[model samples]
Target: MNTRFKQLLQLSAAALLVTSSSQALAWGQIGHRVTGEIAELYLDADTREKIAALFPNQSLAELSTQADSELSNPSEFWQQTWTWHFVTVPEGNEYSLDKHAPKEGDAYTALTSSTETLKDPKATVEEKRIALLFIVHLIGDLHQPLHSGNGTDRGGNDVKVEFFWQPSNLHRVWDSGIIDNQNLSYTELTKWLSQKITPQMASEWRTTDPKTWIKESIIIRDGIYPEEPKLTYDYQYQHIATIKQRLQQAGVRMAAYLNEVL
Candidate 1:
């Protein structure tokens, strides 16, 4: 092969490796976990029926894969899909903005965009379902601490550090480190969190709304800014419970939103 072709092959191999590695920690894992929990608690009779009708006999993994691929390209559905990929910062920085400083954007934009795709007459049922599912996932992502990161770090992507003696970025830590450290299955973690949730707590957690979710996530980002992330088992130990709670909530709320919509 020519040099260019050789480089292309190398890049493809690396991408595949990264994809395989990410399967365990991808946004989908967290989202689906949340969706499952929320589905259990929040999905109504109709939405549950719809989901069952659309995906009978399919695993969550299968549905998620199908949704992601369909969402990769949408009908002339909404404003660019890329626009929905960000989170908005709350007002109060020195940037001299209004009371509502919009740093990133809102989950509403994403939901609206996804809705547009779903509503497009030309859109396929699978495409619409996938778009709706993405809306479900993005709602959960908007609540993750790093997902609402400052423009400076691109949500900690710029902050390089080591996680358990492994070289990694700060963003990666929040994305996967804490959850992976627990060594619990997603169901176990969800059950663990579900037990702690009181009716009142769930009630309050569900009402915060998406804009509020982003604001809350931004606050968390401040605390998570790694001074020197030499995190080992001890560090993970210190925050293991907290991490599980956050991840669990992500799933719970995602399902809640979808249930409401359906």
Candidate 2:
């Protein structure tokens, strides 16, 4: 098989394995890969070469999901990273660095630190590797509206509901429930989205500021919560466009961020 064909098979297999094996988290494997796939399209040649030097074997699509999967680690380091996948702004307010800054650190803090680590000449290869991984995952997470949660409801994890008659929460619905319901592999979704993302859209979404990205998610977050306990096509219909846009934005912004830092 050709390389692109093999890559698609691998991505499909990975998506199936991760979806079946773990509880979905932070856009799950598919959304993470979708963002990564999109980012690869926009990465300049120099940035691509730099990343390839750092990671000869793994692609950005694979690394983008690593942080979320690492949550299964029993180490203190992993435990501390739980907050890094998300940030909570109150439902009514915009993100304020002062007020939203958690002592334990959140996505915003982690994104900044990771970027600095990657840019530091003194940093080790391992440090840069880990930083790049966080940068990829956190970019995807910040675009996920639920991850930019309100201080209440644990980013909608507490909001119980039935998604397509299955027991689910609002958070999972946004993460993977709706996407999963569509029955497309990450590669398929990525291909479709790649075709749809115009150069203008990519440019518009290419803001390098993580704070601006988080603020966008907050505005989307405040508007997405549903009053009804049962969700189906209507909910998915209303929000899938937002979901697609956020994924595309994350990818575009991630490329810009990486090109600037690396």
Candidate 3:
């Protein structure tokens, strides 16, 4: 292979490694990988067609690649705006007391934004692709329990600790430890997960709201935080099934979100 092709393959390999490790633990979690997969799958035909219109000569794969790159390291402007969409209206005083729930009318009230933002009509094809991709990941992130935790912790960043004998911070461990322990490729992991997903689950998890997702994560997060210095395979397997389910759901839902607005 040419040097450029070799480099591309290496980059893809690295990304795959990053994504697989993210499953067990990472700043992002399976949400990122699942959403990434979904964004690649769920874009509406019209949006896909529109993006093609903008780039008459480019293949869909190429466009998607460009989009992923643009979103790899989002700008501050993109982060804040995309972050807001994940906020949900808190249920009531009951939920209000729970810091995770938003107040009746918070600055980030989700209703204010449409899924259309996921694919801005006026932006360039690459720009829209980037936006859509980010939304996919952000939606998944919103569903992560730590992402919705108390602001002071920076989503577990404040918690100092070790994991699996590794000298690491709380957030860092969860971001990339346990899953890194798996030592698998993205294709291998996805295949293993896809085989386990039932049709009923795929249908049920397809939704746009992030609050409900976050609530689910909060429950999982609660169960995960035990006063222990080391985590074992048992701890990892405790929710392996659920973790796979979440990733599958994220992919399907991400596609739905883009299909609706794009």
Candidate 4:
């Protein structure tokens, strides 16, 4: 086969892989957009202007899904970035670069790397734009407790369950089920949750430290497993608040990072 034909075959395989694996992406598209919209609200005026210049017609909400969509791209960057959506901080141990972070990268390292990219004067526009997409995606991903998971169970992907009478995994339930279960559009969800975020809440959540964010997610992950694997209204009732809080916090923190970096 010619080089061009070989490239086409590889691209087709990657696209198939993306289709099979998109369900496992952090926060699905809606949850990530919700965080992006909320982050849009909290951006500094100057930062907003700068971001507009970089993104052209794109809003953060649209950009939020870019990384997940890129899973289909026939590129090494996308291959490496698939791992950057989540991390394993094994139960009972705090995260450390030497102990927990792998050379392959994780949401924590991705955030730090993106921040540095945006902050670097020498970085090209395309480089910073790719980094910005990651910030938009990874910030929300880390907030999904399972993304900062125990090394086992594939971040609860292995812990299968029935969500509202349908087959699902624990990770999917947290990633999109709880929020998607509401049937609200991303804008409505963002508006509803954004109102509850007080000045103090956003201020308190403004830390740029990814370790602190991962720590918070790890604590929440431990308590989230349901005794009954078949989840319904009661399960939603018990955990919906945590989902809302994390979504809101992710948005707040995402904005804070952009405000500080850009």
Question: Would you give me the overall lDDT of model 1?
Answer: 0.55
> Tens-digit lDDT track for model 4 on 139-217?
8888889999899899999999999999999999998898899999999999999999999998898987888888999
Q: Write the per-residue lDDT of candidate 3 for residues 1-262, one digit (tens) a residue.
A: 1232223223332232122111222224333554455445556778667545645654332322231233333343322332332333222311232554344322123322323333445443443434433454455555555555545555566676666665665555555554456675554665666666677866787776655666676665656554765655665676555555666676666667656665
In order, candidate lDDTs are 0.55, 0.81, 0.48, 0.83
Model 1 weakest 10-residue run by lDDT: 13-22
What is candidate 4's TM-score against the reference? Answer: 0.90
The candidate that achieves the highest lDDT relative to the unseen native structure? 4
Instruction: Show model 2 residue runs off by greater than 4 Å.
Output: 1-23
lDDT of 1 at 128: 53
Task: Assess candidate 4 and give its lDDT.
Answer: 0.83
Ten residues in sequence with the least summed lDDT for candidate 3: 17-26
TM-scores of all candidate predictions against the true structure? 0.72, 0.90, 0.64, 0.90
Error of 3 at 59 (Å): 11
Better of 2 and 3 by lDDT: 2
Error of 3 at 173 (Å): 3.4
- lDDT per residue for candidate 2 within 7-126, as digits (tens), equals 322333223223212434799889999999989998999999999998897788988887777666554455467787898888778778799978777888888877776787866666
